[model samples]
Target: MSTLGMVDLQVNGFGGIDFNKDDLTAEELDHALTAMLATGVTRCLPTIITAHTECLRARLRALDSAICNSRLGPVMIDGIHIEGPFLSAKDGYAGCHPKDAMRLPSIENFDYLTEGLRTPIAMMTLAPEHDGSTQFIRELISRGTTVSLGHTRATRDQILQAIEAGATMSTHLGNGIAHMLEKNNNPLFAQLGEDRLIAGLIADGVHVPPYMLQSWIRAKQASRVALVTDATAAAAARPGTYTLGDVTIERGTDGIVREPGSPYLAGSGVTLDQCVRNIMNWHGYDLATTFCMARNTPLSVLGKSAIPSVGDIAECVFWQQHDAQWHVTGARIGNWQVHINS
Candidate 1:
């Protein structure tokens, strides 16, 4: 079945627009949203990565204004995902975020940005190894936000502690940290081994291979997996140089390619639609499973209250199969069908 709507839970930025950039006006976000919709993403969590506290606070405030005021043209702001500032300091697997400001566990810092949001935060990524990390997880859980593990070097026991403390998710499982203790003792295996926790996968083939995605889906069945763009300013932007936080990301033809000197993927350039495409084409997964990974699973991540509905600030898009490809047919906001293609 070709589903009509889709949801993307972890998108950092799009069309040269970063959620963490203070200069990224509402108009730029609108442009990004428009591009996302064209690719079949109806709802999304615009993620903000770990950086300077002031920069993080400013981004949160800007997003709050845009969502409350509806300042971004035709785009809908579903919520936000604060990726980090508190994570492991390890070089390779911790990814390409700024190292200086990164801390382990700081509840005071978590409260700073969450308190500033006008809309709810869909999720937050934190490492369990930091001091008071468990307490921070519980606090975030009580506030109705999903806590995800990421950019961490936590041991298996530590991950279990975080999960028990209310951290029931993982952010881009295989992309975060590269070096890990062998066997099932690291975050990747720890997250994959648990049936209760949900993990977001890139599914772009570049970030994760087909066999791994297949194995993950088979291991967790259909209910525990979700797709994330992890997109940067280069998501829909043409191949060129763009910025993520304070770093420079150069986009290439095969999608956003990281420099040779980089450790992990610099930042994702994949889109929600492309992720769906890969699951179907690369891994040969069924359409229903792809839709679930791209939509329903993420909805589950938002908890039960904020789930999609006809009268509750609904956002969705429709597509129908046309020959060998899927073509966008319609888009809606609440009850209004705002855009229609063919």
Candidate 2:
């Protein structure tokens, strides 16, 4: 069967390559992206999560340089997704991001991060609970960057305010929240109820349990949802330790990535293809509906109009399914076409 190749909007690293490191080489970036393409991903955003100011800047420069220097980077890298250095520092809302590194949004911080980078910051995730978030959301959108709310305990009003200020998305909607919620007013309800926001969801059963995932897809109506890997170096690799920015995360044999001693998830080790299968497995959605979450919907949040129309076979994915598993047999990207031996 044929479909649009998957687009990953929030992948941190893949195939043993961590994009958070400032010492990555062009060859390494190419290797990681190649691994991604083999798994049916054609475009992605190399996400760099929260870090100290200097560390964040250094990592951005290194990633930008590697992308500019790498062969596959230009074709596969849609843009960069900066998850945070501006999220809620609360206990559970923080996820695996370093708490002390997060700060309130600032124009100076945004300028500092984007100073001379060749690759653009296509999307950024932040919290609406911060005092000046409304203005920062406005500034980010004004600069043509897609703004998303994440890793916060923002009330419904706060979320609405941020939406009014131009935040149009939520990152990993069901996963970045505090496990125990207020029952009536919470981040999940606030974001899910707002049709203005397209939710980026990590369908890895590890990040979100299967039953809840089913409900999330149902509530979002499956149309305005986007599937994101939010993967780390542990992704597409066997269980072991990996880097997510400066933090150390371990992927257990169960396929959950977390800090050495923490029970909370650090990042995921799921691939986009696996995620597509996962949604269908958990919710019984047809392939076409599931593919839209991984392909067209994400680009829409970024205001990108590059959706492949009918008969646009120039760039496409060829796949086959066996026993409920989807395998990427081959793909076409521009003038390039090759078989994937997976």
Candidate 3:
């Protein structure tokens, strides 16, 4: 039996550090990477959520430096998934992006933010409802960036139109929009009903229930689904006050959620390793399929040709199973054992 390795498709912050802050430091990036490697994630898309264009662009510039001349360990930032400022503001389904910062998608805005990133943006999540959004989708695809649908109120036809225009994915598929909708047409179902696109789901059990996870995996199959964390500063930190730039999360012993009086679950405190364990326990998916969903499948969605091949960026993890329970034993970074868990 082969042990599973993980690739996190979305993570905002880790080790009590946040990406959205103007003060985001390269040392914080190293801390986040080290923590992820300890939990068996070899590579990750360090997601930066929607914010003021200038703030996002500034963080990207700093992150580019850390990523290009990496002194960090195995949990390197392979690319980024810039997950919105261009999104709907409807309640119940929209993300935690501030109202002032949220707006329609524009190519000029995206270019400003991603100009200096070393790894380049692998994907961007936006609502298709904004003006010229379809043309924007085409442009990103043409530039070799994968576009993902998220934080939208798009109808089935609208989503299909965007898909036709080369929008290839749904970011955190079931979590970005309102929960209840008119029968047969919502962003969640619109995405679930389609097969041509890949969708990312947070399996931490807070975002989507077990039955929903089963249905998605059944509909899309393992190869077309990617597991994402969408984690924040609380990920590897002790449960307490954590900041995501200007926003704050109150992570108690009960897990992470938004601050007092808020109803939304902001992001997860779950590590990528914990996400794999939850999928295995909740759905009974095969280990190979699980690993592929967590790793190779996301790489494919980001438009990479070859994935995890020998002699090509030797990022891997070694874990042991005893009595059907797995534990991350170690991890690697391009032929070097970067960390070993006792």
Candidate 4:
């Protein structure tokens, strides 16, 4: 069967390359995208995580240059997903992101970070609990950016307010929250129950336990659930040390990416194909539903048209399904095509 090309809205890095690197190169970007293509991902938003304001801008400029100069980046990268600098700074909510860099959301800060960039910020993940986030989210929406809430401890009412202000998505739901929560009243339930918010889930099993997947998907509804890989350089690469921005992280043989000696997950090592397969195999889902969550739903969240047919676009993946197992037989992007195995 043929399906829309997999679209990952939150990819940090892949293979052995770091998208958050201060001096990202075109060759490195191509290597990462090529590795991603083998797994049937035809497009993605290269994510940039938390850093100091000035350093973050530098990273953005460097990444913008790599995308413009790289062979595959022009076709593979949809835009940038900025995930930080405006997140919950307290303990576990901060996760692997540096707490020192976290701050309240502001338009001036956004302009400073995104100034002079060739590539646009297609999406941003920020905490809505901040004082001015309601207005800030409105401003971001006016500029054509998709706003997603994450790393937050906002009350359900605050989340609703942000949604009212045009925030339409949640970044990596079921993760990036306080270590403990009120079982009856929490951000997780708020996002899961909100029909207007399309929640991004890292279906890598490590991010959210496998047993919880079915319930979370059910709570959010399949159509409003989109798959994402909050990947670091560890993704699609062998078990080893990799860089996540300025921090050095280790991908154990177990495939968990974390800052050295820290229990908090730095990012994910799972590819988008595995995410789809995991959902189908874990639950009784068919490929159609899972594929839509991975591709069409995410693209829709980014304000892009969904794939109505296999031939609707020049980029898509040809799949061979045998019971629960699925593999990419071939992938096409623009004029480029390649055959591959799982």
Query: Could you tell me how far off, in angstroms, the CA of residue 85 lies in candidate 1 after the best superposition?
Result: 1.0
> All candidates' TM-scores?
0.91, 0.96, 0.93, 0.96
> Total clashing residue pairs per candidate?
3, 0, 3, 0
Better TM-score candidate (1, 2): 2
lDDT (Cα, tens digit) per residue for candidate 2, span 1-342:
987788899989999999999898999998898888878888899999999999999999999999999988888887899999899999888888889898989999889988999998899999988999999999889888899999989999999999999999999998778889999899999999899999889998877788988887778878889999998999989888988888899999998888998887888999999999988887888888899899889878888765666664356788897886777898766665668765
What is the alpha-carbon lDDT for the whole of candidate 4? 0.90
Evaluate model 1: give its TM-score. Answer: 0.91
- Scored by lDDT, the top model is 4
RMSD of each: 2.5, 1.9, 2.1, 1.8
Summarize candidate 3's per-residue lDDT along 1-342 as a digit string, tens digits. Answer: 334356787888887877666655667777778778778877788787877878878877766666665556223666777888888877865667776788788888888778755677878888997779999999989988889998888989899999999988888888877767878777778888788789888888888888888888888888898888888888878878888767888777878656545877888887877778888988887677677888878878866543554656666678778678666778766554545545
Is candidate 1 or 4 superior in TM-score?
4
Model 1, 228-322: lDDT tens digits are: 87888888788887877777788887675574445346778888877887788876776777778887888788874335556666566676676
Residue ranges of candidate 4 with Cα displaced over 4 Å: 308-313, 322-324
Candidate 3 — worst ten consecutive residues by lDDT sum? 66-75
| lDDT (10s digit) by residue, model 4, range 143-255 | 99999999988889999999999999999998888768988678889998999999899999888998887898988889999999998899988999999988899999999
Using alpha carbons, what is the TM-score of model 3?
0.93
Q: After superposition, how far is residue 323 of candidate 4 from its true place, in Å?
A: 6.9
Model 2 CA lDDT for position 339: 84
Q: Which stretches of candidate 2 lie over 4 Å from their true place?
A: 309-313, 335-338
Among all windows of ten consecutive residues in candidate 4, which has the lowest summed lDDT? 307-316
